[model samples]
Target chain A: MGDPGRDEPLAELADDLRRMVVETLCHAQAGHPGGSLSAAEILAALFFSVMRIDPRHPDWEARDRFILSKGHAAPVYYAALARRGFFPEEMLQTYDELDSLLQGHPDMRCPGVDMTSGSLGQGLSVGLGMALGLRLKAIDARVFVVLGDGELQEGQVWEAAMAAPKFGLDSLVAIIDDNQIQLMGDTATIMPVEPIAEKWLAFNWNVLEVDGHDPAAIVAACAAAQAVRGRPTVILAHTVKGKGVSFMENTHKWHSALVTEDLKEKALTELCVREVR
Target chain B: MVEMVAMRDAYGQALVDLGDRDARVVAVDADLASSSKMDLFAEAFPERFFQIGIAEANMTGIAAGLAVMGFIPFTSTFASFATCRAADQIRVSIAQPNLTVVIGGAYGGVLAGKTGKSHQAIEDMAIMRAMPNMTVLAPGDGVEVRKAVFAVADHDGPVYLRMSRDPSPVVFDDSCEFKIGRAVLVREGRDVTVITTGIMLGRAVEAAELLAARGISVHLLHVHTVKPLDVAAVAAAAEKTGLVVTAEEHNIIGGLGGAVAEALGEHRPTPMKRVGVADVYSESAPNDDLLQKYGLTAGHIAQAARSLMERRAAHAQP
Candidate 1:
């Protein structure tokens, strides 16, 4: 995993963190497990390896910004924020609960969240605006956006896609958590955004791709994206919905539902074993 | 008398002034700078202007994002697009979070004349008023429009500034100070009260003059800020004048007239008449012609006030 001294391997950390995702969902008794599980490594790479963010000072001016455009996958974001020390890890147990800091979707009131987002396809435009505003203020900070495959069907995403590179936001990086599944079914069947990389390329974005579940690949791909100049970058990550759990893998049933105590135990046991990517 | 001018022209000048005052204030347009009168702002600060090219939703979300970064963005376009087309985007991105994003609804109300009903936004005030954390405003003329623009910029949260494209008779002097939620008392009389908003203030003022000639005393209140409507001022007028006639260049429902009626209904319980477009779409005509056909002219307001006065007199006779 090319882990430098004084640390654990990236894949091991990502694989271990999958517990928090299911635990958050299980405690809440409702959430999107499919998308959250699929984007674990991607989020791990962003919060742990790639992004220059300080959890203690989540609102730090010089720190990087992260916007979860695909907000329904909030379980993963909440999990990552907790693990990264934005808040108490125990707070994950209160997710989706009334009066809890963790909301059903990503809300900026919670620490480490840049933009409050739930409605699809709007996050990219905001990221575009933030990038432009940052450039105007002479802030060299980077803005990272996480979008879902089905979320690409939103017209606002395309509107944002056209604008980012037009402004030449090389510091802006958009990672499409392309887990293949949408809310109802497969993304290709529902909307057909394939040749997605070419579409971004046509929009003049610097394009990259990686296995979304592979932590090291996710980190390396983001590094490559940041290296590009004079253009925004989009990393299309291929992943299976519900990647960790055996029966839930590539299935839409786990997109959102209760993770009963029985299923939670099985899922946690399955994710406990360290898997080399 | 104040110099007659268009609210749109005043808005452009206000932006230029605001550019000098607040560097955080940025303008985003959907490629209708000339119509929205944002060309002045663009000319003054080229680097600050963002031309989004007819994508209203994109403009709103972009502004919301900019607002998150401490820029007080003023997103401008026709009222129809600013309020209707990008409503969800505005609601989710700006309004819900209560960002310091100012929205300019240029060509607001039926004043978009000749461009027809599609461009007219009679329900803009209604739509914006419904959103939580949204400060909705409709300035009547050039002097007040400038004040309203500056007031909303200084305001803390999200605001929607409804601007008229039609040139109107200026009703306020340069010294007129604008407040966000307070009603400005333009004229005072004893018999009846004429409450109006947007371009209809000119007509209401004219109506007051006509009523005075006919031996009827007409009090006039110009309501520029619709949401956080100065209900206290409205209740005071309702208590004093007894008979109330509300006017606006918008639908009689859910706008200035509606807000006044609702306020008076709850507080003062005064007999009132609403003078505006009678719950219908506007047709293609000159601005004045449209105002005439929709019964939004001075004559219409005078007639409404007269009828209400006569009703009050008849009730008094008994």
Candidate 2:
């Protein structure tokens, strides 16, 4: 609602992101659909509007860096990267296959992935390192790390949290996809990280929150984070575990399950995508 | 007496020198800067030094990120924490991407002395050598430690540089050539071969002298690089002497002893005896007493060589 002119296209891109994730997971028959679907808008907003990157030169020295720390949601990351012209969209068909550039998790071998990440609680630390390196080189750039709420249980995440503020890394931003569910069950049932905003504020970070499915709000939040100085930022995005389809929404069953052909058709119909096959 | 310099001090000085030469070189320490001797580098380049509190896992992950951004990051901590505490971080962040990050593991082996089993890292070499794309280096003396620092900086992949806490002995000089994957033939003899790695080289050299006094010829090979081991050199030494002895200040299981045995087992089967800690945790003791108790002193090496020679002689008579 911030700007209808720009918001309309990003909303379209968000739908395209969700459709591609469903299609990619359908082809692989094995992926984490719940988290991938939940992150559609956040990925769409960053790849399309918030980030400064060149699709052709993914390794440009001065380009802004992005690391998918919750790397299990790799399908959505690949879709967004492909949609941004980092690679041909057709490569999505080879996701998770042997020798495929689209690995089950994000790998640096694939274009547009700044760092190879799959392990949880590692991305924020890596982002802090990148922020430090970029500052040392006098490069004007930012490092963005996307994390999962459930992944907050990892002690290393708090270790990084305690260190980033000490370094005064204003160029680093961490986005927590508060999708509520993990591989086991809801984060509240497994291990609660509730009071999430208070936790970040206590750790000396500039905290922000938004409806994760709202592309306009995500863009605004990212811009606000960029404007902050002297400290890192953490944006808590409230989202459903499975944001789009009917049966899969807010369920852990689709956290890392196979998407059947019929389920794929139903999901595509919900996202308003014309299924090719 | 041979000139003595602490391996940690040499490693620290090497970092300072590297920082002076390359602007991209940086150091990360996990709150053990003074103990690990990384404070020397921190003092030299304050802007490039990063003290990551006491979190080894976070420090390692941060180093990986620095490596990704084209900076050569050296992370230092005690061997026990560097390898075991941050193991998954090292494996996933650095080794998986084959990043050019050097891990400085200080007080490696039981030579952290008097600190007891918790501080010692007798299995560090085995742990690092097993990781894919990891280059493991256990320098024997001050000169080799310095050379290894510059070498791993220029190297394109991950490397773990194991160092000791105390000053023991200096076995090599600046003129001594040190290269990754190339074992140095410190001495050549005919009767028996005593292959040594890390600080054990000093005792190995002394052991050779003892054998010489007893009219026994000993061949000595000093292996500074453990992974991508010089298999050809090990095989040739075993082939010539027909008797081999591996001496190390670590558990004989999966240490240099195990590596040498595996190489010789495939290339040339020979009569062998491993001289090292006998796969048991050691208690707090003085350095000398611990070395003697674990059969890692020069005398123990000599005994192992003599026993191997006796076995060979007995076999020949039969």
Q: What is the TM-score of chain B alone in each candidate?
A: 0.98, 0.98
Worst 10 residues of 1 chain B by lDDT: B1-10
Error of 2 at A137 (Å): 0.7
C-alpha RMSD over true interface residues, each candidate: 0.7, 0.6
Cα DockQ of the candidate 2 complex: 0.82
- Candidate 2 lDDT over B1-318, as tens digits, reads 689999988988888998999999999999999998899999999999999999999999999999999999999899989998999999989999999999999999897858899999988888888899999999999999999998987899999998889997898889999899999999999999999999999999999999999999999998998888999999988887989999888889987999999998888988899999999998789988999898899999999999988887787894
Compared with the true structure, the alpha-carbon lDDT of candidate 2 equals: 0.91
How do the residues A1-277 of candidate 2 rate in per-residue lDDT, one tens digit apiece? 1222234477777778888999999999989999998998899888888888888788999999999999999999999988888888999999999999999989999999988889888989999999999999999999999999999999999999999999999999999999999998989999999889999999999999999998889999999988999999999999998887777898899899999899999998988842222
Model 1: how large is the Cα RMSD against the reference?
2.3
User: What count of clashes does model 1 give?
Assistant: 0
Q: Which predicted model would earn the best TM-score?
A: 2
DockQ of prediction 1: 0.80
In model 2, pairs of residues that clash are none
Query: Estimated TM-score per prediction?
Result: 0.96, 0.97
